[model samples]
Target: MDIETWMRGYETAWRSNDGDDIGTLFTDDAEYFTEPWTPPWRGRDEIVRRWVERADAPGDWTFSWHVVGVDAGTATAFVQGETCYAELATTYSNLWVIRFADGGRAASFTEWWMDQAHASDGDGDGEELG
Candidate 1:
């Protein structure tokens, strides 16, 4: 599948928190890495379960992303999302690498994410961290 189609399905699944939706994004024996060095959630079932474990309930966050590049079977993208809870909000910056299988499902996927800077750091104004 093209990157746009695949990415739209991905975001839809994430926002819906549907197991079937999540499972459909991967191959039967897919691997998902939360970080480069961390052990992956191997296989579609495990990937779905682990992903659900970390899910944010529907309507909790908003995400926007753009494809960075695609080559052969692999594609990379940058995603930005903001989540709000208890009157506090946090923004996240994320990078994802996805290896698509022949059928358009992911054979392997990896993500790297970090929380964006807040407006204040306990003082009066927010300062860049050097």
Candidate 2:
């Protein structure tokens, strides 16, 4: 499946915050790693549950992404998101590596992200510190 098409479904799932919607993005035994070294949410059930537990409420965030590369069954992407909570707001960038199985679902997915420093008034966008 085309990466962008898959990502649109993912974005919709994120917006919906529905376990069933999220589950459709992965295989039965999919593995989702929040970070390169973090323990993964193993299986579709765990992935859906964990995502629901941590997801932003509907209409609380905006996401923009573009596929960086795709090779065989593996794909990579960069995503930027801004979350607006009642008392806190933040923006960050994420890099994802996903491996697709026979179907459009992902078998293994990994991500790396870092919070951008808060931008001061009139300071333009925040700088990313390594």
Off by over 4 Å in 1: 73-87, 118-130
Each model's Cα RMSD: 4.9, 5.1
Global lDDT scores for all candidate models:
0.77, 0.77
Q: Which stretches of candidate 2 lie over 4 Å from their true place?
A: 73-87, 118-130
lDDT of 2 by residue, 1-130 (tens): 5677778889889889888889999999999999999899999999999999898777776667777667763444444444334335666667788888776888888887755553344446654333
Estimate the TM-score of every prediction. Answer: 0.79, 0.79
The superposed Cα distance between candidate 2 and the true structure at residue 100, in angstroms, equals: 0.6
lDDT of 2: 0.77
Clashing pairs in 2: none
